[model samples]
Target: MSQSLQAAAQRLERWIKEDAIPLWLERGIDTETGVNIERLDVTGAVDREADIRVRVQARQAFFFAQAYDRGWCPQGKDVAQKMLQFVQQHAAHPTAGGGYTHLMNPHYEVIDSKQDLYDHAFFLLANAWSYRAFGDAAALAEADRLIAHLDKKFGAANGGWLEGDYAYACRRQNPHMHLFEAFLALYDATGNAKYLARTAELFALFQTRFFDESNGLLFEFFNDDWTRLADARGSWVEPGHMMEWVWLLDWYSRRSGRPVQAYLDALYARGLAIGQAPSGLLYDVVAENGDVVDTGKRCWGITELIKASLVQIRSGHPQAEAIAIKAVDDLFTYYLSASTAGSYVDRRGADDEVIVDVAPASTLYHLIVVAVELLDHCEGRVQAR
Candidate 1:
């Protein structure tokens, strides 16, 4: 590994060990609720009055699932198993649509019974990863159940998944992207065609509904009929999502050997063009017409951008050198230097002048992402040089 990347990876492992694992083991357990709490304030206290989002437990499952890949800690795997048990016992609810609810109270009781594609997608991701980590059949079964439900309820007549109902049926890129992510994990874990086929459907959905060939960037949202909801509905462009999709696409391309070079290049170009702010921090959303939607600097976008940049660089694009430098510099200034005890403050403006909040889990995961990718990129670039 290159020195720079090795440094990044070492930092990531330290943060995960010292910050994420211990904090969650102590505070996030939520003994009273039997599920993980969503928010822990800066004072290291849980918000007792805050409503729990079921998706948070799902996310924690994903965190532990990733332990296998990084190989830094074994406790994460144990924590993940405990978390899955908590979810199965407390958070899950049966809906009329034969799906699960998105909302739950602080006590782990169902608050909203309406089925949502967003919630289901995260569950699928968590379950898929959990199974991979522990070889647990129940987790795999739950993943398969969610996949079956997605196909049954969300699959469109024309061959793409639709967003499930809370109020109404709509189709959006968010769920499809995550579905692809979950399916990728399943495919890697089980070598199952069902998961691969689902991923293909999601890929087509992106090409048909989300990707804008005219501009080479993705549309933020869409309608049930796959019509462009061109207003603010389709306007919010998250650079993190763009970066994420790039990494995923590259992964798929490598696995399938499908020659996705053109698409990858375009994605990198679009992300760099729109995401970079004056301070070198990546923005959250750039409108469909290429306007900045959210100026607030979140660590998520920066980490994802680093991920994409590394993937592109390692995948044989030396041109990303300057881009990676700027990204690293900006990240250290805006995120890394300010981080405390594994948590990073969300910057409220373009210039990083205001601190909105500190979120540890999200920040820590991004740090891992950037670190691993940078490690890969540095190694690849060093060999090339």
Candidate 2:
């Protein structure tokens, strides 16, 4: 491992162990309910009025479960269990499907009861992580039930799953990407061929629906018939999503022994060319033809870019370590909180100034993904596919 990367990894490890986890454990959780708060103020206080999205709860559960596995938090598993229990009590949908509702009030009353595809995918991922971390049998069973529900209700007439039960003019590839992620998580958690088979189905969807083979751009929105949704600005794409897909593609390659270097190279290269700013942060949105439609930078985008760089390093790309080191440095300098320790600035304006003051607990999921991966890479636990 490069010395710079090792140093960066060690620093990140300390930050997570000492600052981030402790901060969230104390402030991010609601004292009355034991569930994670949806947001935190600039001073690290919980925003108790904000409605809690079940997706955020799932993400926080994922973070805690992952922390337990990493030995970063000894009580992480219990915390995760509490969050899941809270989810089961309040977030359960009224439908027969195994999915949860989209939103709940601060006091755990139902706010938005729609059974959302995105939230379902995340809860599955959370359950997968919980099962992997603690061998929780119920988590595994719940994951299976969720998958069955998805197959029964979410199955679409075209290729992938429907956006949700709600009506929409266009379908989104974002949720499908996350479902692919959850499938991989399930496979890793249980050495099951069924999850692998499901992942392969999503890969096929990628080839025929989400991915544009001619130009290599991942379209975010698609018509009901699975055609690209476009406007005067052209088909909208996200560099962050490209980087995220690159990481997932690399992970799939590691597991399935498939060669995905071409896709990784194209998507990462194009993402950098179009979406990455001069300051090393990634833009929130961009056009297919390389125009920056939105110049704001989000914390999640930088985390995805960091994960992509680590996968590149594992692939033995010559400059990956250097790129990754710089990305880590840039992440701290530009996005993460300097004053607040665990909390982070969620987004930045076009001029690279911090625009968002509130720290949403949901972002901890993104940060933990990179943190654990970087720690593994630096410790030589990461193996090249």
Whose lDDT is greatest here? 2
Off by over 4 Å in 1: 32-34, 168-170, 325-329, 336-340, 360-385
TM-score of each: 0.89, 0.97
lDDT score of residue 292 within candidate 2: 85
In model 1, the worst 10-residue window by lDDT is 376-385
Q: What is the lDDT of residue 316 in candidate 2?
A: 76
Please give, for residues 1-385, the per-residue lDDT of candidate 2 as tens digits: 7788988888778878898999999988876787888988888788989998888889999999999998999989999999999888877887665788888888878888888888899999999999999999999999999888987988987878888888876788999999999999999999998998888888888878878878887788888788776664238888999999999988888888888898888887888888889888899998888888899999899889889998887777787788889988888887675478887888998989988979988888988888888988777786578
RMSD of 2: 1.3
Q: Mind giving the per-residue lDDT tens digits that candidate 1 earns over 82-150?
A: 777776665566544345667777667888766777777778877887777778888899887777777
What TM-score should be assigned to candidate 2?
0.97
lDDT of each prediction vs. the true structure?
Answer: 0.69, 0.87
Q: What are the per-model C-alpha RMSD values against the true structure?
A: 3.1, 1.3
